[model samples]
Structures are given as C-alpha cells and as structure tokens.
Target chain A: MSVLAFIDQSEGQVKKGAYEALSYAVKLASQLGTTAEAVVLGKLTDDIAALGKYGVKKIYHVADEQLNHLDAQVFADVIAQVARAAGAKIIVLSNNSDGKAIAPGLSVKLKAGLVSGAVALPDTGNGFTVKKSVFSGKAFAHVAIKTDIKIIALNPNSFSITEAGGGNAEVSAFAAAVNTPKVKVTAVNKVKGDVPLGEAEVVVSGGRGLKGPENWGMIEELAKLLGAATACSRPVADTHWRPHHEHVGQTGLAIAPNLYIAIGISGAIQHLAGVNRSKTIVVINKDPEAPFFKAADYGIVGDAFEVVPGIIEEVKKLKGVA
Target chain B: MKILVCISKSPDTTAKIAFTDNNTKFATDGVQWIINPYDEWYALVKAIEIKEKDPSAVIHLVTVGGADVEPVIRKALALGGDEAIRINADTPDSYYVACQIAETAKQGSYDLVLAGKETIDHNSASIGGMLAELLELPYVSLATKLELNGNTVLITREIEGGEESCEVNTPVVVSCQKGMAEARIPNMRGIMAARTKPLKVVEPVAADSFTGIVSFELPPAKAGVKLIPADNPAELVRVLHEEAKVI
Candidate 1:
C-alpha cells in the first residue's frame, strides 16, 4: 500500500503547491508505515526523478500530451484508476484550482472520504482525523475519515515543503489510457504577473482607501520591491479597480502566505476570512479603529499615501534595488 | 433549456462566530442568515441572465434544508427562478447533499447544473463536482464566465495564474464564481409571481456520510498589534524585515 500524491502541473510545468503536497504525502506515508508514490498526468518539463528530494520513492508519469488541459472528469478517472492500481490507501492533492476541480469527483468515484482545505498533518494515533479550515477560515474543524481510503486536498501554502538532500527515486511509465475529453479548450487568458498569488510567500494588498485604481502604483511598487504578489479587497475588484483574480476575500481566493500586508483595507470580516491564515499580518490604514487592526500583527495608523511611501523607500533600501 | 441553480444560506458575513456544546455546534444566537454570496451573486444571477436572454429557458433553484430556509427559496424564486425544490434534510455533509441533488437532477433531466463554487458556512466546494461524479457527467468548477449556444456550453475558469476557456456538451455541471453576472434584486412583479411559484419539498435520498466532525476550533487570536506611530512607518518595515523575517 502507498500514499499517492497527485502532483498538479500547468503547461507541463509543476506548480509549487504540488511540491508541498508531495512533501506532505511523504511524511504521511512514513507515519502510516507505507511508501510515498506520485502520479503526474500530462508532460513534464522537469526531471521527475529529482522530486525524490521530497521523499517520493517512485513516480508514475502518464506522459499523455492530451492530459495537459484540464477536464475534471477525465482527470479524476485517470487518478482513480492509478490509485486502484497502486493500492493507495490515501491520496494527496493541493487544494488549488486544479485540485479543487478534480478532488471531489475522485472522492465520489472512489467512495473515499475527502477533506479539502487541510491545514495540518493528520493525527493517526487514535483514528485518522484531518484538521481543515472551515467557514472560510473563520474556524478549523477536525474531521475523522471512516473510509478505508482517504483523500486529502491540502490547502496551498498551508504546508511547508521539505527537501531531502540528494535523493533519487525510480520513475516508471504509466500506461493508463487517456479518455477523450468531453471538455474542449478554446483559449487561455493568463494574468500578467510574476508571482502567482497562490504560491507567493508575501502578499501586499490594497483597498478602496487608495482612492482609485490609478493610484495603485504604490501598492505594486511595494509588492515588486518585496518580490511579493499583489491583492485587493472585494470592493476593489467589484468596482474594477483591480482584476477579479487579485481579489482576496471570503468570496474570492483564500491565501495563506508567510506575510500579508494590507494597505487602505478596512479589514471587513469577509476580507479577513481569505487572508487570516497568513503567518503574520500588517495593517496600514488611516483609521485607528479599523477592524483589521485587531487581526494585524503590526499596524500603522496613518494615511496609506503617507505611510506607503515610507514603506516603499525602506523596502527598496533593504533590497538595494534603487 | 433547463438550468438548475443550487442556492445555499450562510451566516451574514459580519456575524460573530462562536461555538456551542463544547465547540461541536455552531452557535446561532444573534446570527443573521442570508443567501450565500457566491450562490446569490454569481450562480443564481448568471442563470437568471441566461433565462432572460432566452425566453424558452427555465431556471430551477434547489436547496437542502428545513422550512426555515423557505424565505431564501422564495427570494430566489422572486429573482426569476421558475421553480424551487427543497430537499427536506439538513446534514451539512457535502456528499449527502450532492447525492440528493444528483437524484433530483436525474429525475428532472436537467440540461445544465449550476452551483456556487462553495458555501461560506462550510466552505466545502464539493457538491457540484460530487454531483457530476454521482450522475456520471462532466463538471467545470469555479467558472467565472459561462455561455450556452444550443447544446454546447462555453466556460471560462481560473487555473493557477491564468484563465482558460473550455467547451462542453449539454448535461454539464458548473460551479460559478464572480464575473459570471451581477447580483439581482427582485422587482415588484417578480416578487408577486414568486408567491405562487411552485416550491416542491421532497424527502432526501439516503446516502451514508464517510466523514464525521470531531470538533470545531477558532483560530488563535492575534498577538495584539505593535503600533508604529504614523511619523515612523519605517519602524514597521524594519520589524517585518528583522523580527518576522518575512521580507
């Protein structure tokens, strides 16, 4: 029996979240006294063998070019078949977009218990129980999986990825037949940014207090200087001050970064629900009584225009960029 | 054309969250319930917009809850859904809910199935995908945009840093997010029409839940903030760089 990691990729490149899932599964496999194996669908640009650093003992590569584009049904079908063939007792996937689209289907198809948004490693001492974020990060829930097979969709950035120095793993060709996709790809529109929000270690976000979208240069400057991603509150996205993808709130993307800095955001409960998982939170707002200040690890009560300039100058100095 | 939109109720965003019974039950006192924003603003409105464009289309709203959830259903009907189905069961488990919906959709022969990406209360974004799996159909999750032309449906969804469009045939399931459509408010005519619109309450189908909640926990409170004076904003940055080492 093995713990199977479903490593997600886009355009043949592995996503950062997949590394976290791989590392997480490896640890779980150790605890369960089983080996960790991984299955990758579609093409891979990187050497699959190198992922052994994460402690995966074996890698299964489907190498199907047609599997590059995602169709949840087709993807789930192949992954389920791989799980059955591999005798996997637990399947691990990152709770990112790809995992979100496919994990639930796989659970239903395999009759496995699924725990999405898993934050911590499971506690197997008593019975298998996984801790997960519920109510949009407002609370955590421990769910006990009673099924023989368990499926966990680890939240992106929730688990730290560990590397095993100079390890090697065996890679075998998986000859699983690819199903003809019912979903047809039309066009792809990618957000033009260097750091994807889901994988960013630090995030600098802005809100309506910035006045207008035109004044977003300061927010971008801080994010760029820190090599962090940029995000905004829901109202900013709703008003088209920023792209919808950058919106971080209960209804938007839930992010868990090492550091999350909010500028001009009032820290509405809905907005905080998406970002409260950050290891540290900083709030800069003119209102001292802003609700966000309560949740912030560090807070500066001042105008964003006045405070952000100082932060930008300091970050640039620290980075020696200018 | 038939479109079934799944509507869900959740505590108002500003409601204070607390637990009862040794952190096993969500406290309801002083909480205000509303239609989950994702369901009302995206999935339901998108379905309404589609129905308005094509007069031949019928929009049906479904929810799994008791009679207390009727107002939300009527409100959905008021927003132009032709009918509503209330599955009289309230087990917050996603798999059981998905099974109930799958049975209902199969009986109705729905051409398209739609739901919010997730419910705010549970944040379990599983129902749509599970429904598709149970019904043996294709599912597109977190679709920001959906367009139906005849039997073919076009969907635009977020994937990592990019957005991709896909085309699928009829009998497709889609979980909607923002950018699908704007939120709608019921007009006087629509409100009156909703009073008489059909709301069929059916008993839930039996489905075993494989997961049980052990307990609920609130995240630890933040260590009170270290307030940096407005004149010295650099202090905050320095602390982040040195103390937190996050920069």
Candidate 2:
C-alpha cells in the first residue's frame, strides 16, 4: 500500500518537477499510513540517496543507458513492474512531457484509475478525489478515482516542494526487462542557454504589438536582465517573429509561472487560457481597454517601445547591473 | 495507407464559460462549437497533407460524442478526410472515450492514428496514449512534425527545453500540436462533397469510467488591476520587489 513516485530525468539530469512530485507522494503516503518510495530510470549526475531529503524512504534505480532517452512504452512497462513489486496502491508523476507520455499507458496496463493535471493532493477521507484544472485553467474539477490502484500526474509548479534535513534514502539497484524501443531517435535540437520556458519562475512575453521581429531585442534584453524566459503570443509565432515553442496560449504551450509579464498583448481568451494560472500577471499595453488588464494584477497603459525600455532600465538599476 | 484522425468539438475560443446543473455540467447555452484548433490545424490537416502526397492514402476521422459533434466531424471531412466514424456516447472521461475509439479503430486496422495533443475543453491529453494502449500500438505525444517515407515516419516532438526527432513505423498513435500542419478552411466544393462522405454512427462499446467529476468551480476572480503611471516604471519595480516579492 506504499505510494511510488516516478522521478523524471532527461539526459542524465533530474528535472525540477521531480522534487515536487516526490514531496507530494511522500505527504500522500503518510496520509495513507504508508511510506513513500521513488523509482528512477537511467543514470544520473545527482546522487539517488540525496533525494531522500525530499522525504522518500527508498529509491529504486534502473541504471541502463537506454533508459536515458524516453520511450513511453518501455518506461511504462518498467514502472508497472516496479509498482507491482513494491505493492504501490498509488503512483505519482509530474504532469510534464514525460509523465503525460507514460501515465495513460501505465493506467491501461495496471487497470488503475488515472487523473492528469492534478493540482492538489487526493481527498482520501471518503473516496479518492483529486482537484485538477480543466478547460485550460478556466475552471477546476474535483474528480473521483474509483479503482483500487490510482495514478496521478501532478501539474508542474502546482505543489510545493518540501525537504527534510539530512535524510538518506536506501537506494537499491533494480533490474527489469528492458525492451528495445520502437521509436528510433535521429536527432535532438535543444534550446541554447535560455531559461526553459516551462520551468521559469518569471516569463516575459511579447505579442504582435512589439511591431516586428527586430524589436524583440529589448524583450530578450529585459528577460536576460531579470533572469527570465521569453515567450510570445500565437500571432507572433504564427507570423514567424518567434519560434512556435515560445508561443503560449490555448493551442500553444500552457504555462503556470510564478510571474508572467505580457507586453502589447490584447489578451484574447485563447491567449488567456494558457496563462491565467500564473500566480501573478502583469500587462503592459498602449490600450487601456485591452482585456488583458482585467485579468492582470498590475497594468501599465503604455507603448512597448518606450515603456519596455524604461522597465528594463529600472530593472537593471534595481539589480545593480550594468 | 489508411490513417485514422481523431477530431473533437470545442467551444469557439471566444465563448464565455459557465456551468449549469449545480456546477456539475458545462453550460452549453449560446456557445458556438468548432473543431478543436489543434485537431483541425495539426492532426487532421497533417493527415490531409499525407493524402496530398500520396493519392493512395485514405484518411478516416473518429470522434466520441453525440449528434452535436457531427458538424465538427463534417468540417473535418470537408478538410479532406475520406470518411468519419462517430461513436455515439457522452464522454464520461478520457478512458471511456479512448475505449470507444479503440473499438472502432480496431475494426479499421489503420496504419496510423492521429489526434490533437488534447481538446481545449478537457485539456487532458490522455486520449492518444490510452487509445494506443487499448489498440496495442506505439504512442507518441506532442508531435510537431511528421514525414512519411514508405513504412517509416520521421517525427519531431516537443520536449522540455527542445525538440527531438525520431523514426517510427506505421500502426502508431501520434498526438499532434503546432507545426505539424497549418489550419485549413473548407472550400465550397469540399463542403458540398462532404455531404456525400460516409458518416458512420456506431453505438459506443461498454467501458468502465474510472473517474467521475465530484464538482466544478471557477477560479477566484482577481482583484482589479493596480494601474501604475506609464512614466514611473521604477515604481513598478519597487512595488514588485517590496510588495509582490516576485522579482
């Protein structure tokens, strides 16, 4: 009846979301009067035992290089085996790209109830009900999972990461049947030296109001000054002013950063759907009537060319950087 | 090659969201429905593009919903699918919907299955994976690009900080998003031809829904925006540091 968390990693490095998932699983396990354990696939730069500080009692390591790359099927197969071996009644994962790939297939394999995008811990008092975001963060739904074994994909940044001081987990090397992946990897194109937009605490985004792609220098400069990631509206990406990966909206990447600053965006419902989950939103636009202002915590009715440079200078001054 | 593209109906992006029946159901009054943008712009259109490259390719659409979703399916047909299958049922959850689609897809024996990364309404992104598992097919999520070469397909999918290109054979499930293909509008001739395209409405297969919605609630409304003077950008910085502490 122990709870198990999948520790997601890429290229031998643990993802930031893993700690939050581990913490969530640990808390849930305590509520169930059981201990929490974690399963990590592939090799890692970080020590597996050190993760116990996040409250995991045990860590299972499958130290195969093939596990370094993500193949959802292979990952699911291994996870299901580990879950059965560990007698895990609940499986927790971060609802990032990797978790999204694995959870559904794992549910099918285990015949367990599955919920993705879970924003809070399950209410286990009566039945296991999880609160999650639906309609692209426009509303919330409390969903009940009825199966004996339940799977939850916790939304990134939704749960707070808690750590215990100087704790050590017992790490065990586990072996499972590693299947040859059907998906053949040809190439990888990683974003260079920018704060990953999904993990960024502060995101500075621009829209068509930036006038042209050439005007984006200031946006990038401001983002660098603030140690933030840069994002764009759909039109900006559609028009090829920015790459599509940076587009944030309903049909684009939905994000929940701590602070999202929008410049020159009119805040269409499509655009707002992706960003409404941000803890704080700041809008800077020339139009006071822009719908984004209504959704924002702070607003500055001004042109980006003038206003953004001023903000950049002020941020620089505040940070004491040249 | 036979390809199965999954389509879903979503409220138009501009529609106002509200709930009815004690917040247990979405209020459908006066909401205009449209094909989910990701499905229309990426999955369905990419399938159409494949057909354009190879005339021998046949594209079939599948959707799980009642008669209200037929128009959205027809729109997909007009965009170039050869036919569409409608599993007539209310979607209780993603698993049940995936099971229904899997039943139909099993009969079709499609070489490839495609769906939007997720529907705008549910935003679950679980259908493709569940459907793949049910049908015993390889599944890929967030495919940004796909190119078919004989029996193998080259796919580029979005990862955390970048994109990875991989190759997979036919009989696979792929959930598509932006960059897979551009959105297409139905031409008059295409719309006229869509009326003759076969629309098969099959009864849903019996499946258990593991999850049920206990209740729905709206997020708390934001306190109105605090407007700062355009000239005082420094005040914005000061307030962020001292008050919000987010900077």
Candidate 2 per-residue C-alpha lDDT over A44-118 given as tens digits, one digit per residue, 9 for 90 to 100: 988889998898879999988788888888899999999999999999999888898999999999999898999
Docking class of 2: high
Model 2 lDDT, full chain set: 0.91
| lDDT per residue as tens, model 2, B1-247 | 9999999899998888899999998999999999998889999999999999899999999999999898889888888999999999999998899999999999999999999998898788899999988987888899999999999989999988898998999889999999999887899999999999999999987899988998888999999999999999999998888888989
Each model's lDDT: 0.91, 0.91
Residue B158: error of model 2 in Å?
Answer: 0.3
Q: Which stretches of candidate 1 lie over 4 Å from their true place?
A: none
TM-score for the A chain of candidate 2? 0.97
* Candidate 2 ranges with C-alpha deviation above 4 Å: none
lDDT of 1 at A80: 93
